[model samples]
Target: MTQHRKRDKNLGLAELVAIALGGMVGGGIFTILGISVSMIGNLTPIAIIIGGLIASLAAYSYVKLGLYYKDEGATYSFFKRTYPKSHFSAAAIGWFIIFGYISTLALYAYTFSSYAISSTEFANDIQIRKMIAIGVIGIFTLINVLSVKGMGKIEDLMVYTKLVILTIIAVVLIQHGSTSFEGFIGDMAMDAKNSSTLSILIVASITFVAYEGFQLVINAVSEMTNPDKNIPRAIYSAIGLAVLIYVVISMGALFAIPSEDIIKNKEFALAAGAGDVLGKMGTDLVILGAILATSSAISGTVFGSSRQMSVVAKDGYLPKWLAIRKKNIPINSIVGMGVMAAILILIGGLELILEFGSITFLLVSLLMAIANYKLRDKTNSSKVLTTFSILGLAIGGVLILYYEFTAKWEQMLAIVVLYAVLALGAWIYSKKNERAKKIT
Candidate 1:
């Protein structure tokens, strides 16, 4: 009884919010800032706001389903239970969501490596960055495998501290900016006239991946307290906070740093820009903020997604070996996720990983929205809101694909092939599950 009570109290609302925020705020802003600015120029924050709104739309279904289902498996478990009869649907979503988590893991680790080396001679050293990225993943994977409460405590420290630092960086950059408020607004107006509506919407859709981590709060349902209150509270609070942070930081960057430099530096744009404006002190601050952001993100992603992976494996949608657990922790799944993310870091480039993660999560969230609509009554979900979520998510998904097709067909081809491979794997396991069920 004592042990059970201790387990129940391991995570509270604060920790839950940290996990969600850690996941959302990590490498996302750092990774996408350069790309968004290059595409939309001064209009990046508007796209960010739209992305946040779209994320909120997607979150409705997750919150409702999370409260109703109260399952730690989160996206995979919710979809599985929602359409229990369709094994393929369950298996396919499981595959996509897990890989989506993997891609984001790679993204965060890559961003961490970029900022970690941004001030060093190895700033542009691709091989060294990849090594550092993989190394950090291993470190966090071991921490997660060690203790749940330990990881949560560390995450709270990193997430909250990074938020404070990020806010300071924004204020300093804006104060020391080269452009005044009027000038910035004028630049935005020019960009608005120059950039197309479709371009802005496409950027918004691409930024959806930055909002991908909020649903992670629901994944901690088993570990947290007061699911009825904390689930929605944590998820919504984290998303709102994320939107504010992204906007403030992006505005600061645009005000202080030139667009050409941001485009050139790409992943390390903030750190590079900070060095120019604030010198060593400013650059160091940005690097510190980024490190903490991506570190907590890595820890939170591995923690939540590994548990969900274990759940999926137990359901016979993945290798049964991954279902093994110790002390209520999915050790095998945790290790497997780290290994797979490392492999992705090695094979995929930064942009490919970013785009793939965004598209996959957008698609998975869209499906979750559809599932919520199907069981709206049971979940106490409003039909009007759920329907809107469906339409918004679907449009977001379409916009992203359109951007890929028109702008980078080669990346689009790679993404398509990757989906085909995952589909094949999901199909094979789903059939195996069918046979096992019939025999039973």
Candidate 2:
């Protein structure tokens, strides 16, 4: 208890929201912008809003469970504790959530690499982008392994600075608009006239990945004060702010740039669009914003996900070595996640990994909704909303899978293979621990 209290002394509401925003506003918006705009045109902001609503539905359960469990393990801990008898349940959720984080890690690092090279000769070089992604992951992993306090302070600076930069970039793009706001609206109406509602929902489902990191707040429960009040406040506030930022940025991009450019330079779409519309200054600002956003995201993710990985390992859901810590920092887990993310960067492209991350989080959050609904009385979770959350996320998860199957079947196959491997490893450890317990 004293140790836990000591940890909490270093964090407050500001740090907590910073972590949540850092985890969220990373590569998601940058990557999703091109895809969303390509498919939905000017209605991209609507998709982002729908995405945020889905995120809030997901957050409803997480906040309730976080207040009740207050465990650093977060998703894994909440589910495992709620169903203590189910080893498979614990193992699967642990594997899924950890890998989900890895996928987002890959997503953010890839986006960072993309913007980092948008102006260079190497902008189209896949190999160079992968190398840069691995390098950024290495840098953030080291930062996380060094000191928790140091990581928190750096995250605060990164998150706040990026917010300012992004806001400025949005305003500049809006001010330098190539098309009138009314013209953009007319284009959206035409686009919507030809598009189906299902397509819009599918895009929203894909964009849900942009809101993925808000749960990083729950992982910091042990390091926060007033868990009950602050957990909800921070998570809700972060998600709300993320939605607004995403919409404004999308609107700015659409008003200033053509949809064709957004899709053609999809990897570094925003920076490319800004360069064309606002020239070098606009391009540089967008690049800087992307750098800060992805940098803070990588740092916050390494900080929170590593701790959660440590907790899963402690429960025998993963290799015991991953649980090893120094000065309360999950050094081994941080290195492990970084290494895996780097491997993913080498193996998968941005869109493939982005979809996988979205699907994994949707499933995990759906599970969280189920868990919260089961313990609704204890957690004071609203039965109606929790049920809706479950249904919403379930639909979101299925929609992404359906989108992948219809559009990118190969990526879907790879995701399935990846899940199989994770499940097999989880099952082995789970069974091993259970049998050892019986023998003892």
How big is the positional error of residue 279 in model 2, measured in Å on the Cα after superposition?
A: 1.3
Q: Model 1 off-target regions past 4 Å?
A: 1-7
Cα lDDT of all candidates, in order?
0.93, 0.91
> How badly does each model clash, as a count of residue pairs?
0, 0
Residue pairs that clash (backbone atoms under 3 angstroms), model 1 = none
Q: List the residue pairs that clash in candidate 2.
A: none
Q: Which ten residues in a row have the lowest lDDT in candidate 1?
A: 1-10
Best lDDT among the predictions, by candidate number: 1
Per-residue alpha-carbon lDDT of candidate 2 for residues 335-364, written as tens digits (9 for 90 to 100): 999999999998887888998899999999
Candidate 1 lDDT by residue in tens digits, 1-440: 01122454588999999999999999989989989998999999999999999999999999999888888888998888878899998999999999999999999999999999999999989999999999999999999999999999999999999999999998899999899999999999999999999999999999999998998888787788888999999999999999999999999899899999999998989999989999999999999999999999999999999999998999999999999988889999999999999999999999999999999998988989999999998999999999999999999999999999999999999999999999999999999999999999
